[model samples]
Target: MPHATIVEEFPKTALSRRTGDVLAAAATGPVCLTDHGKPRFVLMTMAQFERLSGRTDGRTEDWTRDLSPEEQALFLAEIDERMCDI
Candidate 1:
């Protein structure tokens, strides 16, 4: 199991910085960010991002490694499930 970090982007950090750090952490765990006292975005690691982006590294991608069709599908499903509440 992975440990997630939910951060309120107000007191100590801004949305942009947290957003960057969240990407790295997202590869390892879920990073939930908030704005205006409400949850606004969810971030996940590379694998999770890959599932979501279908591009191996989302928009800021630097490298590429193809995922098997089955693996990609499975991971994409996991990302979906992770994003769900209840």
Candidate 2:
């Protein structure tokens, strides 16, 4: 189950405050803010933001498509360690 978190939607004038709040909660996902029903701003967690930034040490490999339990555990352990360093 996912943890309950607060995502506030504020008007353009209050974008700065919303951004600050979202950055403070950087371990969670993004808090989406909109303008006239269109996505205007996305406040992402540090991890998410870093992934979006795209300058990462991540590698692409075919092994991710399908994995045995042991392979998955090792892969996830590596990812978790990487997450901590990030």
Candidate 3:
């Protein structure tokens, strides 16, 4: 399971007054910007964005080659389960 990181929340108004602080905090992790006490947007560093979005260097490999037979069977089983749900 993936671990969840705690995000700092700031009101939209803080954007103008604390832009520098907000950016500094985002450098460490995600910062949530809220409007009317509800989350409206998230601010994060470009490196964090790229990491979360799966941006990688220009290299590709056949993913299947890395999977063990049992792992492949489990993957296919998951696909079959989802197909049945559909």
Candidate 4:
């Protein structure tokens, strides 16, 4: 069975009136905004969105790519030794 998600629900009107409070709640976790007693939207922190969407700073280059051939060989040898230990 899938686990149920516990969300904080707020009516659209209430969310509009208490925007600050709603945003504060979203900072902790997702908040379900409801319209007519049904979920209409989800509010979450920017960090949460980034995490869920696999968003990064666009600096995902491999450090080994810039290394000298000798350095690369040494690094690979160290990694192989470490993996063997595990």
Candidate 5:
């Protein structure tokens, strides 16, 4: 879905109290979750994730094929690290 650049921000505690509201905001665009008054996390819908990850069908696009072996390994490692956070 197309969305505006505007991102709704909320403190981390809001996730515990206003969970529904936070999710509702995320449906429209990315939601910024702050920790200790500092921007920390972003929440987005699954469709946005699939689109950003370049997964149209069951498989993902081979955009990394052009990268060198070492570069691809480094990129894959970074992707693994980020996925662990989920």
Candidate 6:
């Protein structure tokens, strides 16, 4: 997969305090962790990592297309919360 241009970003502290949300966001694309407000780490699915690292063919799937209504709502809510934090 091509590197996701629109990656989700959060403070490094969030990785421990909000691991679930970080992971949920990562499921869609890369999650960028910032330490002292500088980009530090990128979290992505193993498949994505493999594809980007040339360990696998570039075929990809859109798992988000299968999200249930409730799951979609939760994801949106998390986005809203992140927006509020901004």
Tell me, by lDDT, which candidate is best: 6
Off by over 4 Å in 3: 1-6, 58-86
> Where is model 4 more than 4 Å wrong at Cα?
1-6, 57-86
lDDT of 4 by residue, 8-79 (tens): 788878776999778656655568888999989887654445545667342322646787755654554454
- Looking at model 5, report the run of 10 residues with the lowest lDDT sum: 52-61
| Deviating ranges (above 4 Å) for candidate 6 | 58-86
Q: How do the residues 5-83 of candidate 3 rate in per-residue lDDT, one tens digit apiece?
A: 5368899899999987786666556788999999999886544455467773412214335777455434444543475
**TM values, all candidates:** 0.34, 0.35, 0.58, 0.55, 0.57, 0.62
The 10 consecutive residues of candidate 4 with the worst lDDT sum are 55-64
Cα lDDT, all candidates: 0.49, 0.51, 0.63, 0.61, 0.67, 0.68
Higher-scoring candidate on TM-score, 1 or 5? 5
Q: Between which residue pairs do clashes occur in model 3?
A: none
Q: Residues 1-86, candidate 1: write the lDDT tens digits.
A: 33335432332245465654554444445566666667677755446555455654353222223665445535654565675644
* Cα shift from native, residue 22, model 3 (Å): 0.5
Evaluate residue 29 in candidate 5 and report its C-alpha lDDT on the 0 to 100 scale. 59
Best by TM-score: 6
Compared to the true structure, candidate 1 yields what TM-score?
0.34
Q: In candidate 3, how many Å is residue 44 off?
A: 0.5
Candidate 3 at 40: error in angstroms? 0.7
Ranking by lDDT: 6, 5, 3, 4, 2, 1
Give Cα distance to truth, residue 71, candidate 3, Å.
38
Supply the TM-score for candidate 4.
0.55
**Per-residue lDDT of candidate 2, residues 1-86 (tens digit):** 22323355545555676655554443344566667776687665433444567644444234444876445435644665587798
Residue pairs clashing in model 2 are none
